[model samples]
Structures are given as structure tokens and as C-alpha cells.
Target: MQRPWVVATLFCLNAAAAGASPANLLPVAQKLPITPDNFCLGAQNVLKTAKQVLTDELAVLCTGNTATTLFKNLIAAPYAGTGTPALTQVFAPRADNNARTSEIMVAFAMRIPKTAVNTLLVEEKHAIVPYDSEAQPPPLGNQLANMKMSFQFMEPPKNEGDADTTFALQQTVDTRSVAVNFKDVSNHELRQYILHPDNFDFFMAGRTLVAPTEQFKKSVVVRGFMTDPADATKTLVVTVAHFLMNSRDQHEQLVLAFSNFLTTDVSKLYQEQIKP
Candidate 1:
């Protein structure tokens, strides 16, 4: 016969467990099995139906490569003056992978060359990448400067019985031209980390974004996975919801217009390095 208080506690615990949603009870990050199916499922949960604002998805096939190598290469790639629009600076406060949490700062330009824009439509299957042929150059208009982004990666709590890790990213975009008023944005992503055969998987759930104005907020889930499609070849799949949050409607529209060009230019930069 249990004491009265003990009986009440047990009843409450059982009730809570029965009422909890799957999203509220994520699996332990360290215990998750490393596999593509699991990775994809994790990615899908990043943004639940109730909180999603905008999303998109892209799948790129590498002729021959494994997911493990692809993950390593992506994180190891030089952060500065690389990729499309060019990353000017990347700094990490905690460099070790074993650390419980890390902070990173990334600076990049947000301009796309005309040459890159022309090639985007021809190569990409997804329609989310936006393009504008008549866009003006920097100083005249259309160029965002000093896009400084900061990211914080936090692992699950060691003693709290928590089971999720997260990444928080914040950035402010200032354009060269005053006519364009784009506000800063913050992305907070809850994700699971899994070690795959030759790669790693970061499956996200519940990504919330707060626009500069604070009043306009949006939630999205993003899935990013990299693996080898075949021997010596690597592939990556990135998916996001169709909705997006922004400071203003115009800002969202402008970003969509140039999304394609920016993505293409960045991809080209990476391809150039891997070309034999």
C-alpha cells in the first residue's frame, strides 16, 4: 500500500506521459540510429503543421560519394571568401565537436553576379529559387552589405533528462541602397544529431523565426542531409516548408526574387573546387 502522496505522484506522471505529443518527447540525440530513413523523418518534423510559415526543398545527387564524407567536407570547407556572394568571415567560439555547445559567427556578402543568375534556371528543379534579370548592381541598389550572422549550437542537457539539441541563428541585413529596408531575422532550430555510416545527419523540428519588427513571426522546419549516392560521389537533400516570416511583405518578395541566383552562385563555387 503506497502513501497518499506517492499514489498521487504516480497518477500524475502516468497522465502526463499519456497526454504528451510525439514532438514534445523527442528521442535522445546520442541514442538515435544513423540511417537515411531516420534522418529524413527527423527532418520532416522540424516544422510541425501548427507553426509552419514558409518552406521549400531541394535534392542534389552526387555522381559517387558517401554521406559521411559529404558531412565532413561541408563543415571543413573554408568559411571566408568562398561560396556564392562569398563568405567573408567565419569564427567559432568552441571548435571541438565534443563540446556541449558552440557559437559561430559568419559574415558574407548577399549579392549575386548576373552570370550566376542565368545558369540557375537551367540547373535547378525546385522553383523556390527566385530570379530577377533587371536587378541593379551594388551601390545603385539591390546589394545587401555586411550580412553578419551568428549561430549557437547547444547540445542536450547532461543531467536534466532532456533529449534534444538546438541551433540558434541570428542575422541583420543592411542594403547598400536605402530604398530597401530588410529587417534582421532570428532562426531557432531544434534538431537531432545522428552519426551515419560515413556521414552525419541533422534532422530538425520546430524552427521558429522572429523578424526584426518582432510583431511578425514565422515558424519553419528544415531538413539537411548529405550522403554519397555511389562510390566516390556525394549528394545532399535540403527541404523547407513553403511559408516564410519577414519584417514586411516586400522584404519577403525581394528575397524570393533573388533566392535562385544566390543558391546557384554558392553551388557553383563549391563545384569549382571539386571538379577534377
Candidate 2:
């Protein structure tokens, strides 16, 4: 079921409102394929629905993002679709223990079913991809970070799975700031990995897990796929991420990197794999 809480962060990006929509003005998602055709998921569900993965120990300041602001500001003007995606980044300084909240709400156009798309996501991600989305087809061993689930690399997804199901992603991330040395680094702990799948919608959320020092590592990712109203034949794959970066100065670089990761990289691989 595409519950109100499914696309927790993405539900707020749409503009069309049914007559029953409340006038309160937080962000209200319009009727779309993934969303119930005639009703709203309600503003209360936007930006605040809590999940078990975001545990109590996560940093208070580190956990928050600019979802409300972006949602509110986007609707200030008319929105036809999830147009160019709204984004914002803010850093909580010493008072809040130096946490930077960087987030983005973007969408990709695809000609595929939500289930197919999501399955590809989990499948492609779970395999090895030394670099991009396309993992060399069969010799998967070579690209698999030496078969490590939690490594100091953004290579590709890997997991310890069984015949029917897979477990959480015990993966590490590159946390060193560009402000620091220019080499690649992955000194952080494992990340929070969650994949909430529905037959008609695609929504997955994950982040870096807390470290041995009990430091905050809950950087969140929220994504879903919905039908494009403008072109019913196509789907609108939306991604909303709230990452805790090292510094606010890394905003530009982060944006560029995320943009590539958000659309170009995965989309290209998706298209290529579907060919006969």
C-alpha cells in the first residue's frame, strides 16, 4: 500500500489539491498514481512522520532538515509538476554541535512501472558496481569491495542475503569533508538502510548509522515513483534526501554529486538494462 507515510518527504512536493484539502498550507501533494487518486495524504504526514530506523539516539540537530521550508516555499508560486526540485542546506554550528543539514527534492522521468523500477533499484544496487550503476554482468566478485558489506567505498550495493530475502545494508560511507584533504575517505560507521517497497510505489530510506563513539549518523534518503500527470505513459521518479554533511561550504559540490547520483547515473543504467 502506498500509505501516507510511504514517501514521507516526497508527499509534499506536489501542487494539485482536492476540494477537501485543508487550507492550513503546509505542503499538500496533488493526486497522482502513487497517491490516492482523489484525496490528500494530509499535511500532518509531511516532513514529520517518524520511522523506527531514525532511533532516539540520533542527534536532535543532525536529524532535522529543511523539508517544511522547501515545501512551503515551492507552493508560494504555482507548481505544474515537481518541476526542478526544491533544495536547501543549512549548518548548525557549535551550539548544535556542528551538524550541516543538506537536502534536495528532485524527480526523474522514466517509462516504466514502479515495481519494475524499484526491483531494478534493489537488484542493481545489491550487486557490485565498482563505480557506476552497471556492474560488470557476471564476474561480480571483482567489483564487490572484496565482498565487504561495510566498506570505505561508494562502489555499489552488497549484502548478506538468503534464498528469499535480504538483510539491512551494513555499509560504510566516505565522510571526510572537501575542506579536509582531497583523498577519498570512509572512516564512518555503517549507514541506516531501509527499503519500503509497494507494488505501485517505490520508496526507500537509509543513512549513515551512529559510530562507535555514539556519534549521530542518521542522514536520511526518501524516494518514490509516481505517474506523471503530464504524460501518463511515463513515470515521475522522485528522490528526497536529507544528508548530514561535514560543512556548509560543501554545498555546491554535494549538489553536483547528488544530481549525478540522483538522476544521470541510475537512470542511464536502468535504460540500458531494459533493452532487448
Candidate 3:
């Protein structure tokens, strides 16, 4: 996959340094770390702890007795508009601190079966408008063959008076399904759907007390794959890496904690799917 955003990041830095003022630079904000004592509620709690935050690489293994049924339910959830269980909002935002709140939403363009995915080249096509409005849209077959997934992040409002805010494009995922023959990990062959984020654009709301920058460099990637471990059972492995660019120490710790919480939630969801 071609990563144009990496080049764009370098160009943006150079342009900002040449013409931007001191006030335009990103500020150094306090980093919130998730410790044993401070770890509370769910993923939402982790995000609420700090205005400026990121996540770490997290992984989960979902086990089920029925492989086919489990895999079908997992992949069909988002496409069915039922939403991803892992990304659900766990806690309400603080009403007193409107400027520091953060929200996440995921949307899919279309739904297609795993067997139907062949020679598909899914890519992110950016535009000023939200949806494509071509005079003659692509055929249903072609559209189903390729897919693009969007992850949106809404920054807190600048003030308590503001209404609903627009969500910024946090990540664009190019998706494809491939068959993998496992040898070392497992003896069974598996079908894997890989999601790669080709671009990440996260902006900080100017209303926040400690605004880092209008836009911050972020790196995030997620993968979900399934394989049959036994005669009738299946195993699903979901791994995600989300973090701020050039961030370390406390900032890294906070994001890692948030990611861990999300991973746990995802695992629980998978377990529930297979229950009688």
C-alpha cells in the first residue's frame, strides 16, 4: 500500500516552520498515565483522563466452539449497521468539561461476503464532499469487490454554547480478504481480512485550554483474522496499534492503557457471540 501521508507530514512541517508564528506551534501538555491505582471504568475513562492522548499496540484472542458462525457474526456486525462492539461508548462524557471531551465513530461503505472478495483494490478517495456523486456510479459487483472503511473522531466543542461538532477523519482503512495457510501458528488454513490505514488526520479543537496543534500526527492500524483451531471451534485474533507520532513516556503509557481496555471489551464481545 502507498502511504502518501508520510510525505505529506514532512511537507507540512517544513511549510509551518517557514511561515507559521510561535503561537501556531504545538504546546507541551500534561500527560495522563494509566497506573494500577488510577485505572478506572472503561475505554472512555481512559480517553477522558487527558485532553491530549494516544493509544498503544493491543491484541486479543477470541475463542469459540463454532468457527463458521463466530466468524460470520463478527464480520457481519459493522456491515449490518449494528456497529462494532469494541468501539461502543462505555461511559458518558463529563458535562462540566465540554472542551475536553472526545468521541469515536466507525462507518462502513458497504457489506460483502468474504468469499466474494477477489482481486479487490480498496483505496481511500478523499474529497471535499462526504459521499461520491458521480453521474454514473460503479456497478454493484465492482463496488462490492472493493471496500473502504472510515474511522471518525470528533473533538470537543470550543465552548458550552456550541451545538454538535463535525467529526474529523481520524483514519481511512483499505480492506482486503486473503487466504493464509498456517504452518507454525496452527495446522488449519484460515481466511484473513486485513485492514490497513493509509492515512490519519486528527485535529485538536481550538477551544481546548491546552491545544496541542490544529492537527497532530497519528499512526493507527487494526487487523482481524480468523482460523479454525479444532474440528468445530474457531479462533479470532484482533490486533491494533494506535498512538501519537513522536510521543513517548507518559503519553505512551496513557494510550497503552486505553488500548488495553478496548481489547478486553472486544474479547468479551466475542465470547458473548458464541454463547448458547
Candidate 4:
């Protein structure tokens, strides 16, 4: 059983509509051997619904890409199905504080060719490449000085037919910006550039994420085998879910259920590579 307050707080955080009870908010665990027919389109529906919930609870912003804009500007559009997308947010902890906060959420399905995920990940790593921005500042507002990126892997579904996979990502950019230094540029030049552009530079690698153990260390993984009754073609169903939060308290839970499912020890590999 879930804690009553947990349910209530989540509802309040999500800005659930009237009559949305606890039962309505929890994610139903999906079972494996699910056919294309069992691959309910409703999961997308639930993700779509989060738009208003997140917008109301947090201040959001976007830059660099259109797909990202669409994902973060989720208020106006329906849940989109596409490549890995990210969301950003700027936050001020106190009225008088000069520092800012940055949060990121990333969502994408684990499909596409083997090279696709690798290629995309490399491209994404450069999106926020480090550069000296001490001379400039963010165009939106004052810099909070301190910034960190929050990453999450939302639930991703697998195809029960042929072998196909994809990944979805949502990123939250905290309002804060990290200070960057250039070895080639003079301090004077760096200062001038930052003051003019209001841009800072920083470097980041795609590090695995480490979720709190007490809470659900959610996995975007699926495990189960089933033969399609219609064709007798062997089918394997794998479902995985990912969530983002600065603190464990903010994390959400995803449940998975399947028939004749065989559990595997993927956590050891997951812990080593997935958590940052």
C-alpha cells in the first residue's frame, strides 16, 4: 500500500483535476509478452497529462532546439513521440540570492538502429559544451551562479513484434549557470565575452544516474517472453521507466507486471553504469 500523504502530495504536485483519486494517479505496472495490441497507447496519454502538472509546479524555459521547445512547452501541445528531448528550468532559491538553479529532464524510446542511440548521445553531449561566460550573462535574467542539470529516463516501451527499441528523455535546466574558464582566452577577454553574451560554458559527459535505494530506483527496462497467440511467433516484452528529481522525495514510482516473467540481475549493471 502507498502512503496516503505520498498519494496526496503527488496529486497536489501534479495538479490533478477534480475527481482524480489515488487510484487514478498511480502508474499501472505493465506485464510482458504484451502484443502490439497490448501495447496500450494510453501510456502516452499519461505522459501527455503531465504537461500541465509540471508547468503549474515549476518555472520552465528552453533554448537551442525546436523539439526541446515543444517538449518543455508541453502546455500547448500533445505528448510528442520522437527522439530524445530535454526540458529546462531556471530557479531562484531566495529573493535576494544571486545564484540560479538549473534542472533537466530527458525522454526518448529505446528504438532506432544500434548506432542511433550512440550517435545521438554524442551529439547531445556537445549541446552544452563548456565555454567561458564570465564576461557575459544569461539573457533571460541574472545568473544564480550555481547550476546543475537534472536528468531522467521516463518509461520506454518495447515492440512485441520484430526487434525494435527506442528511448525518450526529458531534461530540466536549473536557473543557475556554471562558470566556465578558457585556457586559450585571457581573463580580460573572458570577462568581456561573458558580460556581452551572458553565456557560460561547461562540460558534461553522459554519466549513469544513481537513484536513492529507499525510494524506487526506477528502471526503464522490461523482461518477459510470450508467443503471440495469433502467429505463434515468439515475443519478448520489455518495459522500463525513468523519472527525474533533485531529491528522493520528489521521485515517482512505476510498476511492471507480466505473466511467466523471468527476473534478471540487471541492477548490478545498472548501478555501475546508469547512475551519476
Candidate 5:
């Protein structure tokens, strides 16, 4: 059964202490090895390494399990609302003291049935208006589907302000279910949704190998995928794994490692599939 909710208010004698509340960032963050010159370079390296580790980790996790799923490449797209697609070589997940933050990464994964996924395509548009807290903006685009969109800020669990935020895009399609979340802030209001029908063609084209590697500290793990290894016969099924970033270092490491691993001749990490 769905749980119910209640509204509560507490009167605190020490109002100053309550005023120090911090924004809740999700996942975790750690100290990362980064320098201006090597920021993007280091992120790519970390992404490559993390992909390998994730593969191994999945093999162990799925062992003795009958999930039998194919794995695909994890793609991080440019944020919809702000920041365009730009390539930067520097590698810190945290923004410099005085620079506009790099575009947020819209990481996605496509899973295929036993039949096979010939192509992968993901198309998302920028939200027309930012989400509003005081004022409830009308529902976004009204394209409800059985998909979900989730986001988590990279903050250490030890920090009082650390929590994973999730939202489901209420799309109209599929035999599956859908979920959504909404939020509003000063500069921009935001809403994230999962659309119906996983488009495989767009991703397999290899136009954009991976997300831009800027302000991506190697200390946090952005995300990973688990898929069946490509073979001559049959098809590969895949599942994407999401990891919480507790520190800037983890994020930096994941971007660098995943980028290098994806843009290589490595079959274990990623390979072209026969278009269906």
C-alpha cells in the first residue's frame, strides 16, 4: 500500500540553529586528484577505469542470478535547460571559485530484450520554464509515459545536507509503469521525466561518444551499465547501474574512466551491434 503523509511544524527556542539548514545534496562525495590542465583528462581516465570496475562488479553481482540482461553504453547528454555541449579538458567536478558551472550530465541507459537492440536514440528537450516551489507550474509537456527521471546532487553522506532526489516523467506509453519528481529554485525551475520507448539508434551512431568532461571531479561515481557480452549468435541484453557520488573525486574518476573505456576497441566495455 502507498504510505500516507502528514504536515508538522515544530517551535524551536533556538531559531538561529534552525536557520542554518543546508540544501540536501544526494549520493556521496570524496576528495579527488585534479588540476586545471588535467581536469577533463583526469575525468576521462576515471571514467575508463570505473567502467572496467563496474563490468567486473556486475559480473559478480549477477552471478548465480537469473536476470539474463544485456548491457549497453552509458551516455551522458548535455543538460536540457542550461549549458550547451562543449568540450573542456580540465577535470574538477566542483566549479572554480568564479566560473559558471559546466552543463549537468543527463546520463541514460538503454536495455534490450533477448531479440537485440540494433540502435539507440535518446531525445530530450529543454524544459520551457523552471520548476516552481511557491507557485506550481502546470504539468510539463503532458507527454506521460511509463518512465522515470532521477537526479542526485553529489554531496558526502556525512554532510547534513545530502539526499538523492528522484522524479518520474509521466509519459503515455509502454506496458511498464512511470514515476516523476519536481522542484523549483531561484535561478531556474526544473523537472525531470523518463520518456517512453528507449531509442537505441541515436546512441549507437557514435556521434557523441560521451558527455562533456568539465567540472567532473574524479571522486564520485556518476553511473554505470551492465550488459551481456557481444557474441556471434543471439543478442545482448543490458541494464544500467546508478551510483551515488559522495565527493568531487568520485565524479571526476567516473567521467574520465567511462570516456576512455567507451572510445576504444574494448569489446568488454562497448561495441557496435548489428542494426536490426
Candidate 6:
């Protein structure tokens, strides 16, 4: 049965059945140490192709049972879209924010053909304006993408002890699987930001905020590369996992925005030249 609905009005996964794969396996224990410079750095790291990202300072999230469970989900059906592909996401079963931390993973089971990805260089200056840009005219993301992009403000969890919370620039469109706040770690460098796909390659200007929004935060790295496979098609795979604090109040609305941003705004951003 194909039913596209949100779980707890938080996650909207129109995904395929789950299965494990031998070819896509990685040695999780070999992950190295990586202390990113900023939140964007951390989020960007998570967005790398599975193999490159599986091992690193963030091994704790990718090792042991977590690694096994992740690969199984990754092996599911590939998302079949158009000249450009859309990500088919799978949610992890481990939903726990028991500690001051939470793990948030956005896994996409995809088979991107080398030809499918059309990388274009986009400007980054107007990528992220101040959070107060609401009063100003929205800037055009890219002439190619033709997107008048804007930013969203973030509200930290209210009940998680008083930490002098204020409005910080961040992205909504929540996959509120978990909530986390490194109240101890202060990376002030982590501010409002995003790198539109047009600024990179074959990708949608997924209008969703990439900065730390209502829940989780990290590097916002997303890409597709040619790989090795028997099929002459694209040979790249992607895996993303993250941790976010719990905020049901901000949950439903954020999720709805994320869905609308991707399906309505993002899906139409790029105009692909049909190859007949």
C-alpha cells in the first residue's frame, strides 16, 4: 500500500519497502576524528556521499547497530523522478532524545545517473541575508533557478531549561524525529546560511532553511557524483543522519513548510532540457 502521510504530523515519508544490501556496506569502525569549524561544516559533512561520510569524527552516529540499520534503509528502492531526481527519504527507527542530544538522519535511497546531474555554478552572496530581510524584497536565488528565496528564524526549545533563548536565523521544514541542543558547545559562528543547488550542481533549490531552525542543526552538504556500477547510469549514493531537540509546537508547521518547499517550490525550481 502506498500511503503518503506524516507520522505524528512530523514526518512525511512516501518511501519504499526496506531491505539490506551487501554492495553498499562500509567499515563503520574505521571512522576518523572531525571537529568541524561551524554548524554548516558539520551539516555539509553529513551530506557527502555515504562512503566518504560514513567514517569521521562523527563515527558515534554511524557505527555499531546504527550503521547496520542505516545501510538496510539505503538499499531500498531508488527514487525515479525526471531529468533531475528527487530524494526518496527513509526514517531511522532509533528515535530518542533522552540525553541532551538527539540523532536526526535523512536517508535517500537513490540511483543518480551521471547524466542526470547537471552541475551549475550559482552565486552565494545573496544566499543568506540577515534574518530581518522580511521587511526587504526577497533576492533572486539564481537566474537559472528563478527562485526568490528567503530565510526563517529559529526558536530553541522553551522547556529545556532557561538558556536565554532569542530569535536566531535558521531553517524550518522540520523532519522532527528528534531535538537536541549543545547548550554546552557554543559555535557562535553557526549562523543563518544555505548553499543553493544552483550554486552547486544537479540539485533543486530546496527552499527549506538549511540553518539551525526549530530543532536540529549541522552542516548542510548535499551533492551527487558519478560512481562505479554495472549500469551505465549514475553511480552515487547519499546518507544523512542528524540530532534535533523535541518541539511539537514548532513541529507540525515546520514539517508542512518543508513539504511545501520541496514538492511545490523546489520541485519546480530547475528547468531541465528534455533529451529525446
Instruction: Please tell me which predicted candidate would have the highest TM-score against the true structure.
Output: 2
Query: Candidate 1's residue-wise lDDT over 35-96, tens digit each?
Result: 44455444334323223332332111111222233333443442323533432212322222
Candidate numbers, best TM-score first, in rank order: 2, 1, 6, 3, 4, 5
Off by over 4 Å in 4: 1-124, 131-135, 138-142, 146-208, 211-276
- Measured by TM-score, how close is model 4 to the native structure? 0.19
Write down the TM-score of every candidate: 0.37, 0.39, 0.23, 0.19, 0.19, 0.34
Between prediction 2 and prediction 4, the one with superior TM-score is 2
**Lowest summed lDDT window (length 10), candidate 4:** 187-196
lDDT of 4 by residue, 84-112 (tens): 22222222211111222112232211121
- Give candidates' CA RMSD values in order: 17.7, 12.7, 21.5, 21.4, 23.5, 17.5
Task: Please write out the lDDT profile of model 6 over residues 112-169, one tens digit for every residue.
Answer: 4433222111112222332211222223121112122344434422222111111233
Model 5 RMSD in angstroms: 23.5
Which candidate would rank higher by TM-score, 1 or 2? Answer: 2
- Which scores greater on TM-score, model 1 or model 3? 1
Q: In lDDT terms, how accurate is model 4? A: 0.23
Q: For candidate 3, lDDT tens digit of each residue in 163-186?
A: 112112333323232221111110
Per-residue CA lDDT of candidate 5, range 82-153, in tens? 222222222233423233332122222323322221211111121111221112112221222222222222
Task: State, as a TM-score between 0 and 1, how close model 5 is to the true structure.
Answer: 0.19
lDDT of 3 at 126: 17
The list of candidate 6 runs beyond 4 A from truth reads 1-69, 72-76, 82-104, 115-228, 239-248, 259-276
C-alpha lDDT (0 to 100) for residue 234 of candidate 3: 30
> What lDDT score is found at residue 51 in candidate 5?
18
- Scanning candidate 2 in windows of ten residues, the lowest lDDT window is 36-45
